[model samples]
Target: MLSQPLSKVLGKKTADELIRQGLLTVGDLLHLLPRRYDTWGELTELAQLVEGEHATVQAQVLRSTSRRTRGGRPAALMEATVTDGASTMDIVLFGGAGLMSHYAKQLAPGTTVLLSGKVGLRRGRRQLASPRFQVLDDLSEDEREALLARPLPIYPGTDALPSWKLAIAMRTVVDQLGDEDVPEPLPAEVRAAHRLVDALTAWRWIHCPQDEEQWRAARRRLRYEEAFVLQAALARRRVEHESTHAAVAWSLPGPQSLRADLDAALPFRLTAGQVRVGEEIATALDSTVPMQRLLQGDVGSGKTLVALRAMLQVVGAGGQAALLAPTEVLAAQHRASLEHLLGPLARGGMLDGAVRATRVHLLTGSTPAPRRREVLAALAGGEPSILVGTHALLNESVQLPFLGLVVVDEQHRFGVAQRDALRERGGVTDPQALPGSQERRTPHLLVMTATPIPRTIAMTVFGDLDTAVLDETPGGRSPVATHLVPWEREPWVEGIWRRAAREVATGGRVYVVCPRIDVTDEELTDLAHGSLGVGADEPDTAGLEDLVSALGEDPSPARPLAAVTEWAERLAAEPALEGVGVGTLTGRMSPAEKTAAMEDFASGRTPVLVATTVVEVGVDVPGATMMVILDADRFGLSQLHQLRGRVGRGDRPSLCVAVAGCEVGSPAYHRLKAFAETLDGFALAEADLELRSEGNVLGAAQSGRRSDLDLLRVTRDARVIEQARGEVQAVIARDPGLEHHPDLAAAITERLDEESQAYLERA
Candidate 1:
């Protein structure tokens, strides 16, 4: 049943609907397990039911009615009044007339049924809307007993095919299975060691379990399988990468290299974490193979210093280094930062014609034509230099004749192919070098991300690359005090402006962030859901409890939205912020306007700058020590952490005020509280993983590729991923090309997309 097409089992119309929902194959359907289970073993009286809890109730129908909805949308509502023991409740359903008529039959007066759904208040009266129902008259004694003994699975479905329809299809598929053996990809020894049930049993228990333990066991087995396949693929990629040779491995420095000079010229002492990561990169650059490393650090963790140390080595060895930034703002920031850190060492002493004025150049899409032409000519001339740019570096016209090192900041923003294209430029100087030949001396690659990643995710997604972490911040960095402000409280709402005024009076600047750049709420929903990493891939159908459990609070729907343009205008006119310049910055603004706004805020001319997420990464204004985030609940954990890091760089203590109008019990509420309680990015990152799956962090969400995770969660399955990683390493060691395990190799290939396969080969 798991191997045949769905069209053969379900009708063509149903199959097409499932296909539209991304269920392309029979295996796809099998992997669509329920998000949660519902127990129907016992029935509760209407008076015993608690608000917000889902429960099954047995009651006699007292009244029934069906009527068309007010709007002319061809929809109707079916309602029934039921009484259990002492209290009564209303049952409501929303659908077409056909569905309402169908429910009207089961809800006849004096009918006895078991109804299950969330208990809520509708117009001050208890009600259960769109619940699962079973008519007692149609069930036999044994059938009723079995139904009461087992838990029902609840799946995410649409109106055309509800949860009941999916359950019926699943039952038909299970019945058709009969005694045939299902395909099991894992080896027998592995399954036996883990004490997991066989594939066939796992599938049955996952969809139709008699007890909680059975479904839990089934999930473990499936999760292990998913982790195993992913680790094996990563292992193969690592093996292939290590076996290749590089064309231009730069020589290591002796005692008096420019890298040592740059390190000694730092204005402040290096942190322990920075020194450690810098050494790791230096060692990799000295190796014969082109280095492929990931440099991860929290915001304000001195990642730039480590990258600069690596770039200096390339320049000292008579080669050019290129740094790719995600945005033009960051590219300009990097260029200014490197020039400031380089002191006067970037002058013509290290390499010929490398004057400090010409050594560090910025080349973005907005560069003037004259400057762009001059920069292009200098790059083609083979001068030892450091060029920082955005996507413009990937253009075919730009060339680095002696490129030796490529550093990418916020690597997830650019696809793997774009990074490879820059590295490929290093080898293109020699026209005779073949595309995939070892004679092509590709540049050593170092990718950096300020997004603190959980260890499990780093291993699973970037297993092929060497990892170095910078977790410690340098001395003199003040800790930013965080506070969560509920907009429902009038005092807190009014105090937001007062806080900004006080900060400005102290000669410090502030940052005000909004979810949307424009005045409209057109993308507000997308902004909220996107922050949670739920969109085209993972849909959000979670209930109040799911939200509460993940967010650590109940949700409210009365939260107000913050728009950048509107907030900027409001703050500028506010009497509290008197004589304080308030400026608006957004992606829609011109580059010159953005630069001027940033300059005004940096120079203390503008005490307040209201913007969107454009300033989320690498916009360093140490003088700004106060940040106010409006609609703070709309952001995810990692994003919130990054925004808070914007302050606390100066000698004075900093403060971050998160203003939210979100409901009290919502996931957003919980997330904000959790963020306010801790400043550790790593801890917040782990929580982010549980709240939001590792989709965005893994970069698969951006690539439009299948994450290939059926049941495995990187946050909870760390031990399993480690175990699979070890086993796959041993297997790959014994069979380098996987000749002895063709099935395993084929499975890995099937799991990886073409882009990933190419990325692995290029790296």
Candidate 2:
């Protein structure tokens, strides 16, 4: 299907060789684009070199050759220099081996050219190392000089295809088409209002702009296209999910009576925000549409109270509620705390009197196979008024009878697809005519998170969900003081501990956290040696199993701080962690195991349990008052904030010490240090977006997924993303589907096709 048509055109590789890299479609060929184009327009005057700073010099080859100096690495060194006549500079080219055929070696030099490269001193002789060089052609020196005055366009490259070659190919492709088939995606009025241009024109100007205006117009169009496509896809996915999921009819008995019952039973009064959110949830229940709301707050901001109140409304409506947490630890914690709050619920209603009205049951992986099966059976039989679990609740075999509401805690921890998956199974939207059809009705949802996200980011990530933020932490709770120590600062950390000892003397407890469990056997040995007193070997969440087993076996009065990082194995090993009552809690633990661990930690039976950064988001442990972060430099500021949040949860005072060392000046160190200073979520969020990219919005370094447009920084692109969201919604409202609009469909298809391909590859 492919042939060397280009060989006659450029005398380079024929079409046959190109096909080997999956280059078959015309679209693929165009996307080959360019890495960068050269402008021989401006030649740098060599006299301006500062001797120390690396500089970019653009000159032509006056002369060149290949040679390796006495002790230097091998190279094709081209010595070429250009002059402004007033000042002449020396230029030596190194590592030009890869450019042998690019006339770096073929000329007697004097070939007027553009040489853009990093200028450094080689043996005090100024040299340019492996920078881009282009043989000046077609234009006079003045014209070339004019071209060099502007920024250049760069594109993608592959192992075999050099960037320059890619640029040349792109120039060839654009030559044939010549920006003739540009498509306008927006309507005329919308385009006029937004100052948008056509995509093809943008692509052309991005490669070979007529001027700055053309270049900027092109960029705006392309960036908007990117933002529009992603927003539209997200919108489409959300709409599809919302339409497909089941919705429970919320016919709660009476909020006035429910409030009275809660007031009589609840130990503390609801905050203003909590009361307002309850009204919203109550209002949502009365509507035909399913409630999809996010309840956000920092640690101990009373999100659980709001959620429980909403659940009580669900039960009052004669329907069940389901709560799903990322980890069983969080799930069990939710169940226990919820049960406590709900204990004083109304008696004549579902949560009270005769038959244990609204029955509550926990369904987790560790619920014991037989018992687990029974829990599934109970849920099927509608035995539980509220069902709580990890992912097990999403199991196809697990059925929810009249599940009216769904609460997902820490929603950011889940992928959009996974959350939609749960909503699809448990939540259904019934048809217009039928109210309850056993087929379609989405459960009202209240998504809860303690991460304290900035409002801007929340809008960007959860544009579809209603948001309720609780900024005020409960009164009387002490703010934990944070400290950053370079691993070598043992004395300083000890001083903090000396202070903490006094706090401990008053019946307070301490929690030491780590980044990971032992990922290696060496880490295990180090743990055994207890060498982490100064700087922890980056905490591995893996060795948690071994550490738990070891802690249970080696119970000693010497180990005062129960490490929370090693809990995976602690529960897997024995029923009790420290004879003093220690246990582990984590994402991997089944709901039952987490329930047990949380109980142990909360009750002060297991004063310390080893765990991962999962504790970065608060899981109520009132008794714990002290926290030690091992390998403190390994955590981000946001994470450090969350980890410190675990403490200072109760009426007791709390303290946090970041034990540093290993990998000083690491990103984690910078993050933790910042965490030590700020209690503001918005500030940390801005810093996070600045210091991180999409891959690290949560964690993991992203290599492949970053988009090509650098102008669309999420930090700066907020306005554009918001505009796109609004425009897409308006357009969809007007057109329903873009079936009649070929241009919009093409743009959307390109995005979905790419996203689908990515999903397939990941799968």
Candidate 3:
């Protein structure tokens, strides 16, 4: 019954509306818990009501009047004075003559009613204009008393079906539900330990609570169930991985190995944090059990260097290593950085170098056919080398022989399927097997993200992976000074360019980041013609109604978002940068074009580069000392921090000016302010989670699907999550197959859909 389609229970029309909101099955409707509850006896205080705020008040009508409008086309209007026990307010109703007469009859003097609307001030009196009203005088004394005693549920509803209508639909389905319909998923022992109610009782109380305590208890049970099922799934995945998977044990390099050679050739000393994390990774790689690890570090913290050392160890152990980046630009940058670090050693067999040297190859979508063939030949020959590329490396044509280590940079940018596809290619010969016997070995996986993930988030999203953090930066890298500039203030905006000029004058470079590539001509034409129509020809407005309902209509005219193309032109013409060369870079540019632009900026031929967030990660230019972010309010705190990291890489002092286009005191402005005040990526990550809510932490944020999490908030319910994880680990340890706890096993299957299971499996 719980698995039955909503249409089978409710009518087709109502089911379609519910489906539009992503609720499909009977169980889905049962879980659409009320966001809040309203009590008839606890009326809103009219005297405390603020103008321009929505309110719901229960009051008695003192008097009522209906009159015709004075306009040539006559309309009817009804006016009444109503009073809660302590305060009086006026209510206005406007409609056709017939509707006004109907309203007047329903709102007669001495009538008690419930009204909800936005409060407005009319002629020194508080009034509810065009309010929705429910007459209570028609109800019997017992019915009125019952309403006053019970809490009314208010669901997350739509304009077409408000809270009351949804309540009726829920009542219809829940009335037919029984113990068999909602089976208990938690083990009896666990339930008794946690003092949680049975699943059926909890479901009923959650949707139709008689009082506050019943609802609270029901919510607790459901929240725990959500966490338990998810954690159980993760624990099961861990068990499967440990039992079934094996990886090539790439032991520590010898004193004369490439890893040691590179360490001796390094220009700077590694931070203590880096050394610690490197040792942790080295230990994992030396194990035969497949390594699943997450490396999280702040920007410019030398994550790439640590990853390269691990890669070198694998290569020195007679196994090839692969580094997967999210973009071609970053992939190219990695190859270049590796070559520069390796010097003549990168040439390997092609040039005179150390005996332990190995070649570094680049494979992206745009790689020339001949060069691609050469790279493939080297990999097919089973040579110990490093391969760095984007998603192109995931193609079936590309093979990694004796692949040992897989390093994913900016792991959040790629989906689990992409990462797993490359890891599955690691096939090596088993030493203990007979000669020529090959076995499929899972490569040691290390995923690195510069965007620091909050603690709870890391535990929930990456629970299957062991984590290491590089919290310190190498010495001599100056900390970036951040400032927020109001976009509306002309002088403050001018000061940004002047500051950029000053940096350039000192032989430093500047990066101007914008929110968009460019405003197209078609967009301008649409704006000019006000062509935001809802016809089939205007498909862009398909969801306009839903958006308007969610956000409401803003009275202020919309402003154009800053664009790199336009800003680049405007900045070049600015007097402060009149003589400084300016170049533009965007994702739309060809590979050659992007390389040329970056080369120009790096060489000081173009000391200033205007770009989008394409340079947000792993694009290093040490000479760039200033970053100016236009419409910075459009970016999240983590992204703003990443953009700021592009500068301050050199020894010179650096500055980042965020030109906020949002009004002061708004949520966006507050986010910008929080970002400007801290250089700690972890702190900003927590703030970002709080401000934005943990957005689809279970793969949806990357896959563009709805999150599996419904009731569990990673941040607020950290303790509950921790408890669930501990209990789940113990349960799985005793019963790896969960045969003794069939209900709980079923719950795991139900909670993790195909995609989510794939995500957790890859982890």
Report lDDT (CA) for all predictions. 0.75, 0.58, 0.78
Q: Report how far residue 208 has shifted in candidate 1, in Å.
A: 4.4
Q: What lDDT tens digits, residue by residue, belong to model 2 across residues 1-763?
A: 0122444434346344455666654455655544444443444567776665455554444655555455656445555555544554556554445654344454345555566666677676666665665556667878766666654656565545656565666566556553435555666666677888766676677776655677678778777877776566556655655555436666554635453466567667777877777787778877766677777777677877777777767765556678877655556567777767666342334434633345567776556788887767766665436788766677787776567778887665455455556666543342122323456566676777655333325344525566777877667688777666655565675565455445545666656575444443243343332211111111223213223322333233232332334533443344222234445544444445656766676666666656655565536767778877775554445456667877887787677878765344655445565677776665676666555544322112221134333345576777888888888777776665676566776665654555453432221
**Candidate 3, superposed: residue stretches over 4 Å from native:** 4-25, 43-149, 158-160, 254-256, 343-347, 431-438, 452-462, 516-565, 588-593, 665-667, 697-700, 703-705
Candidate 3 C-alpha lDDT tens digits along 80-181: 999987889999887667767888888999999988888999999999998867789878888766666677789987755667768888988988998877
| C-alpha root-mean-square deviation, each candidate | 7.4, 7.7, 6.8
Least well predicted 10-residue stretch by lDDT in candidate 3: 528-537
Q: What TM-score would every model get versus the actual structure?
A: 0.77, 0.78, 0.81
Q: List the residue pairs that clash in candidate 1.
A: 553-665, 554-664, 554-665, 554-666, 555-665, 555-666, 556-663, 559-661
Indicate the residue-level lDDT of 279 in model 2. Answer: 80
Score candidate 2 by lDDT: 0.58
Better of 2 and 3 by lDDT: 3
Local error of candidate 1 at residue 123 (angstroms)? 21
- How well is each residue in 1-763 modelled by candidate 1, as lDDT tens digits? 5567888887787788888888866666877888788777478888888889988898899998888899886599899999985999999988898778888887899898888889999898899988888888777888777777777888898878877778777766766664353656577778898898987888888888887888899999888877777777777776776676464666676567877777767778888898888878888888767788888787888999999989888777777899988666778789989888886876564543323323788887778889999999887776778999877888888877677889998774555566678887665333223333434566889988776433334443536677888989887789999999888788887888898898899988899988676645545443433222221212222111212232333233344457788888899899999889998776555668878989998998887998876676678998888989887876666667878988998888999999887767666877888899988876776676555555532332431113446677666667788888777777888888988776677667766667657655675
Clashing residue pair totals per candidate (backbone < 3 A): 8, 48, 0
